[model samples]
Each structure stands twice: as C-alpha cells, then as structure tokens.
Target chain A: MSYDFYMPVRVLGGESVVKTQAQRLREFGECCLIVTGGSGAKNSGALQDTQDALHSVGVAFEVFDRIEQNPQTETCRQAGEVARRCGADFLIGIGGGSALDATKAVAVFAANPELSADDIYKMQLSASPLPTVGIGTTAGTGSEVSGVSVLTDTKGVKHSIKGEQVYFKLVLADWRYTASCPYSVTVSTALDAFMHAAEGWLGPKCGEAPTAFAVMCLPILWKELKRMYKTQELPDSEQRKRLYHASLNAGFTLNQCGTLFPHQTGYILTEHYGVPHGRA
Target chain B: MSYDFYMPVRVLGGESVVKTQAQRLREFGECCLIVTGGSGAKNSGALQDTQDALHSVGVAFEVFDRIEQNPQTETCRQAGEVARRCGADFLIGIGGGSALDATKAVAVFAANPELSADDIYKMQLSASPLPTVGIGTTAGTGSEVSGVSVLTDTKGVKHSIKGEQVYFKLVLADWRYTASCPYSVTVSTALDAFMHAAEGWLGPKCGEAPTAFAVMCLPILWKELKRMYKTQELPDSEQRKRLYHASLNAGFTLNQCGTLFPHQTGYILTEHYGVPHGRA
Candidate 1:
C-alpha cells in the first residue's frame, strides 16, 4: 500500500524532439561532448539531429565515437580526458546502452580527472559530474531513464556504477531513432524490454508505481512479441513506435523495481560467450 | 504517439514518512514557514510530525495557520511577507487543496515582494520562488504533485496561477494523515479524486502516461465509490490507504492531462453557491 516516486528526468517525446527542444541544452552550458559508438549513432540519424540541434543553438561540441559494446571503464576514462581537454560543459549520449552508460562514467571522470578508472565504482566523487542528455537509439536498454550504468572493468568483469548522480538531466526520446535497428537487433532488444517488465513485475520491490508501469507496457510488449514469433518479419514504422514506447514504459518499471536474476545472469553470458546482453 | 513527462517532485510515501525522511528538508535550507488552515492540519497530526521533524534536524520554523477555504491571494501575500521578514528558506504546506495552493503562491510572493497579488497570474516573477514541501492531509486536491494553484482574487473571482516554478520541490505523502478525516470530508475528497481521473482520462492530452495512471487509479476509486454508495459507513485505515494511493495516481494523471469542462464548471459552484470543492 506504500510506494515512493522520484523520477527527476525531463523526458520529451515525439518526432524531431531533439531539434525542436534544443534550447533546453543551454541549461547545461555552452560547450558540449557528443558520446557514441561506431556507425549506430550516425546511421540512426540521432547524431546528425543532435549536431544540428547544437549548431542551431550556437553551442560548440566535440565528437567521441570510439565506445564499444559492453563499454569498458578505461575507454570511458579516455573519453573523459578528451572532454576535460576540450572544456566540455555537458555530454550528450546518442546511441544504445553501451554508449549511454559510458557517457555517465565519462561525465564523472571528466569532472574528477584525478579519479582512476576503478575509482568510479568506489561511489565517491569530489566534484559533481557534468550534466548528461540521453537520446536513445535502441528500444531495449531503457538506459535513458535509468541512473544505473553497467560497464566492464580492465579485468573484463561487468560491474555497475549507479546512483542519482548518473541519471540523465534530460532525455529526448524519438522512436524514429530506433527505425534503423535490424530485425535481429529489434527482436533481441524487445525481448530485453519484455524481461525488464517481467522481472520488475515479479520482484519483491514491485509496488504501485512499478505495477502501473508494468501493466501499461506488458500488453504492448506481449502483442509485439507474439507478432514477431508468428511472422518473423520486421516491424513497420507504426509497430516500431509501439515497441519503443513499450520499452520506455518498461524502463520506468526497471528504474523503479530494478531487474532480478535474469539480468544478473545475462551479464555473465554477455562477458564470456559474446551473446548480446538482451539475448543472453 | 507523442508525449512529454516532467514530474520533478520527490515523493516519499508511507506512515511516519515525515519523521523518517526529515533529512531531505535540509536540502532546502535552515528555516521554513509552515502554512496551513487551522484544525485540519492539527487534527491530521501532520503539523506536529512536521514540527518534530524540523526540531530533530535543528531547522527553525514559523507557523502561519491563517489560510482559509478558497484561500485569498492577499492572505497568501501576507504570509509571504511574514516569510520574507523571517528570512525563511522554504515553505512546508500541510492541509487540503486550499492550504497547499496558497503555499505555492506564497513561495512566489515571498521571492518577488515587488509583484502585487494580481501579477502572479501574469506568469512573471523577478526572482526564483522558494522551494516548497507539500504534506497532504486530504486526498482530494492532489496539489502536492500539481503545479497549478487556484486562488481567490481581491474581486472574489477564482483564478489559477501555474507553471513549472510552482511545482513542489518535495512531497511527503503519508496516507495515515487522512485517517483523521470525518466521513463527509472523506467522501467529498474521494469524489473529487474520482473526477480528476475521469476528466483526465477523457481529455485529448490523455497520452500513454496519463492513460496508464488513469487505468491504475480508476478501479480502486470505483470500488470505493461503489462501497460508499451501498454501505453508509466510513472507510477503515486500510481503505483510507487505498483511497489515498488512488488519489495520488489520479493526481499524476491530472498533472499530465489536466481537467476539462466539469472542473471548470465545478469552480463556479464552489465560488458562487458555496459548494465544497470536491462536491462541486
């Protein structure tokens, strides 16, 4: 009968939200760092839109596009060094979970250059992290709404750095960004989103807020998954929009109740067997 | 297919949340002004709990308990003057809709003393409003979560002052506070909560988020309303908790989609015919 709610992220959804709402970026500062992985951001059109928005708002930016799958802490530290050298006032992450997770870590590293790669997990930061804006290109991770960032250490172990500080200051969620996902990626990510909703629904921490989010998303995910299972066809634009919105709802559930055994176990398969995190 | 979500209030729920989460108040500042209507706050035990919490945190406070039903803008202005004179850092509103609504105006007036009461509706403020903490003693108004505040003007017309600036910084939603309500107030407030969900559900702006909230709260409200219709009895503590939670979910819907014709017409009944706001 009791529940707590504290989502502070300002999420703007719709078509061309990034360009239309670009002025919101000025609240962070003048200079910016754009963080992403190879090809995904550029191919999805999120990166171009973000750059255009930054240009339209007259803000300067630097692009760091070397992040890889299961983002490594050292790579994030390197990006942080670049951000510090370039005097970036904020960071905009424009890809899937890996890129967004690395962006959160990079913000911390950029703000506290003295902190080594391992220091982020210690949960102590001498200065506040740079503000972060998340433009999600994948429907699966729901990392845009979550403060938790799962990253790989130098030893190749998947670990999570999580707290209120890592939550995005703003999220520009355009389902069109996910239109570029291939069939396999689309199915895998939708499965991941389903698991997020399912796990959170079953968890002991599931309360009124989480239950509401789960109820809202489960039917949408179930219908899409059923269609995918039966047809083995790529989703149309309208279906893609539904899946993206469902994932966002699942993200809200995950943000509240968190995931259980499957998510924890999935990370192991991702690290050892090279399975996609969602498929794992 | 398009939506925007931006609720920034940190809501802490459950019994005795005020005492348990008092440390959050420190984030606002060293001193506070406690605003309320006379006996409802005292009867609900919210005022005493707030005082104890403030004392425990070594934060000084002043109590301004003069707010009345359909609270006047001038009264809010006078309270703001008191707050300004005392150099209060924040405002804690405890009571139903009127008191909480007044607290929002007081925050603005306290910050911008030069602005007359009429100027609040103009949506201009020279200074940033003081942070507000809302403690709901009644379930109906949902002012704890909403940014809009309805006030009575000098000419006795009802006007609403609203924007992101008026949103509460924190909301302590302890359902037990409603346990002291009499049967009449309880039924009236429950009806108001139900109307909020219904109006928002039917509104054009009822997107996924608001629709989800409406779905979650509607069934609970229906069951309670039906029970009240059949049985001429007051709700027990457990039922009270359910009702309060339903009201909060409805509040989220109202926050997102807002109200429609019935709410606009209800204001007229309350203003001219002396109807209770919820009943109106």
Candidate 2:
C-alpha cells in the first residue's frame, strides 16, 4: 500500500460541461447549497441553467446567493446552519472560491457541528466533511483543483482548511460560464492561478511530483494571463488548459510544500489592512 | 473569487518522515487500517514504526497484510469488507501504489458498497472513504500525489478510481524507509515516476494547471530515481526532494492529461498478453 491522494469531484469544464455534469450531480447528493456570486449566476442565466439542471435531476436545493467577495466567517457559519437544518447531504459551492470556501466550511461544520470556526486551524480536532462539488465560473482560485479552503475568520484572520477531505467531489468548469466574467475578475483569477504554480515551484517542500513541468508552464500562464488582462480576448481551452494544468501542479506542490514567501507573508496584508484574500 | 488550485496531501518524505509524521497521525483519524505489501513494510520495520506511532497516539488499528503486486479487484473488495467490518475510520495504505490503491478502493467500497469496481472506469464517483493517510516507503507509483486509484477488475481489466475524495489527508515520505526497498522495485517505481513525468508532458492535457511546472520537474525526478535505483544512497533531502517534487508534478500532470500513447497502448498489452501495469 502506498500513500493516498484524493480529488473525488468529477470535473467537467467546457461549453456544455455544466449541463452534462449537472445531470450527474442529480444522481448523487440531496439538497445542494447553490452558492452564487451575490447575484450574477441569477442574472447571467447560468443560475437558471443550473436550476434547470437541478430540476431535471429532481433534487431540491436552496441558494445562498448572498456570498460577498472574500466571504466572512459569519457567512460560512450561517451557511453551515442552513445546510444542517436543511439536511443537505451534498453541497454545491457553485460560484468562485468565496462561495466554495464557504461551502466547504459549511458542509464540514453542518455534518460535524461541534467544530466551530476556531477548530478549522492547522492544529485542532477535525472530521471529514459532507460531499461537495464545485462549479467554476472563473478560472482563477483553482478551488476546484485543491483541498485547502481559504476563508476570512470573523477577526479577518484568513484560515485555511488544509485537508484533502475538503476537495470538491466534482468541479464543473464551463469556460462559457467564465467567458462573460468582468475583465477584472479574469485577470485577477488567472494571476491567482499563476501564483499557485509559482509559489508551488518556489516553496520549500516542493517534492518530486515533477517541479520542472510546473516551472515550464509558469511562463505560459504569466504571459497569457497578462495578455488576457490587457487584451480581454480569451485563449482557447487548448491554450488555457496549459495554465489550468499548471495551476493544478502549483496546487499539488504548494499543498505538499505549502506556499512560500509572498503567500505566507501575505497574511499580514490581509489581516492588518483591508486587502482581499486573493490579492494580498 | 477565482479558482483555488492545489494537490491536498501533506507529504513528509525522506528517511525519517514516517516516524516524524507518526506524531501527527494522532490528529488524523481515530482508527487506522494498516494496508501493507506482502510483508514488505513489516520486514523493513516500517510497520513496527507505524504501530508504534498509532500506539503513541492512543489510536487503534488492524492490518490488511496480504496486498500483492499489481493488486487485483478481489484484494480491494476483500480489504474493503475487512475495513468495513473492522469499523476502521482511517486507513494507512502503507507500502507502494498497489497496497495504497487497493486500500483506497477498500475504503471506498467500505463506505459506499453499491458502486462496483466496474463502475469507476466509466466516470469518477464518490468513493466515500474515511480519512486516509498514505506513507510511501517506496517513491514510485506517484500514488501519493494522485487521486487516480487503479485496480484490476475480475477479468483482469485494469480499472481506475479517479477523483479527489480518495486522496490521503497526509502523505508521510521518509527516504530512510526506502533504504530497504528491493533494488528492482526501487528501479521500476522510480522509472514509473519518470514515465509519469515524460508521458504527462507528451499528453494532450499538458495545458492544465501547473503542467509547465510539473513538466519541468520531470528530469529531476528521472535523474534522482535513476541514481537512487543505482546507488541507493542518495539521502540528501535536497536531491531526493527534487525527485519527490518532480514525481508530485508528474502525478498532477498525469492526473489531468493522463499518460499519452504509452499508457493507452500499455493497457492493450496487459489486456491481450500480461504485461505488468507499471512495465513500460
């Protein structure tokens, strides 16, 4: 027996991947926490499509559509209670990492209940969580690709849920969902993905999982994310997939070695000032 | 909120990592199922150390000690039942990928009995497993870094359990453990990690997250695994860490793009004749 690795979520990212995957999600969980970015998913018709998919699956769900940027601990706790009360067997963290992180914490908290926000730190008694699936409307965060759920605590302390058990059971990446993203979001998220790769490469414990591959892909992400930030015309999946792959690598390495320098030090920025979780 | 990318297992490899990590396992699951190779971890004293670790944590465990090379479906099913009957909350797939993969499947079957070995290949599913921790005494397979769990079905068809849910919460790697690895297994597994990097680079999905970094790390793993196979004395964590890092990248890349022609074609070789799953 060797070591184990987990990413149980079935990820599908493309034009039709959302609907196709929604069909699959129907068979699995109970009520979902249909997390959205304030109101975009509702307005963009993606929410309607998602609802349509849920209806097709015949699964009941409620939306925690009010998740704000850089979700606060209070919000996650509220979501947790809702999930617990709703008897939500499965959680769908449908928006970006904010909602997703909230979904992760809420699912775990709802299932276990005893673990408060305080227990989520690196050293504390923690249990496995309720099953979850992610839908990426943006390509950054790569929350879909990792197990660490970064959330801002009430005191604004960024707490990261560092176990693989928190990885989403499914990550549906519909590039089309991200296509209409505000230009600012695209650049920032892509930059965040690049950072995941860069930090992973530079991190102290970067293991032999193949660091060179991650390094090589860095330039591509750097160039392209920058280009999209400036040009705004998106790269096709073939091109974008490279960075996605790199982001995943970055996630793997960083998760192993952990984020070095900027990431570790960035907490000061987030905690002291009012910097957003992703930017700092 | 953008995507958050990461490979979630916290790895502690190089010589004394198992012993070092044993302290932390107390924070892992309550009960662990020590999944081992056909007596390899025992002979190496790794099993004894693991036992000591569990005992120190005041944790309890049972061993599934009969895992074989190129582990088959029956092993997983049987082990899964054993784990279920034992009510094991945590599992330690303690040797290489065979034991690890089998242990992963067993955890899955133990959690969700309805899904058969055959169902995994068609699509990724919830392998509802207890929190699993993998300790790699051997650095091949890259199983520590991947969620792809492969097992031969009843007809000897190699099926894979793919997704994040099966990933280990923590991966403890101690190069010292490899001190007793048979020269050949060491060679093959190292080569396998090498192939994982090479093939992942060549595959179509090389464009995904951190593939560049993963791609770049290949040679380092190739170089060290080869040297380790030849000399068996590369205790320098710096060097071994490089290989470990490369393998992690390769694992991430392969998980995304998978092996290209070689992996696809190798399946036929196994199906028609009888090539070992790792034999390239």
lDDT of model 2 at position A139: 61
Off by over 4 Å in 1: none
How does each model score on lDDT? Answer: 0.91, 0.67
Chain A TM-score for each of the predictions: 0.98, 0.84
lDDT of 1 by residue, B59-173 (tens): 9999999999999999999999999999899999999999999999999999999978778888688899999999999978888889899999988999999888999999999
> A55-169 in candidate 2: lDDT tens per residue?
8788898887777777766777677778878777787777776777777777777776676666655424455677887776666676776768877777767777767577777
lDDT of 2 by residue, B154-222 (tens): 787777777767677777765555556666665666677777877776765555443554545666766
Off by over 4 Å in 2: A1-11, A42-45, A74-87, A105-130, A142-167, A190-217, A225-280, B1-11, B24-39, B58-134, B137-139, B142-170, B181-185, B196-217, B221-280
- Using all chains and alpha carbons, the TM-scores for the candidates as numbered come to 0.96, 0.70
Candidate 1: chain B TM-score against the reference chain B: 0.98
Label model 1 with its docking quality class.
medium
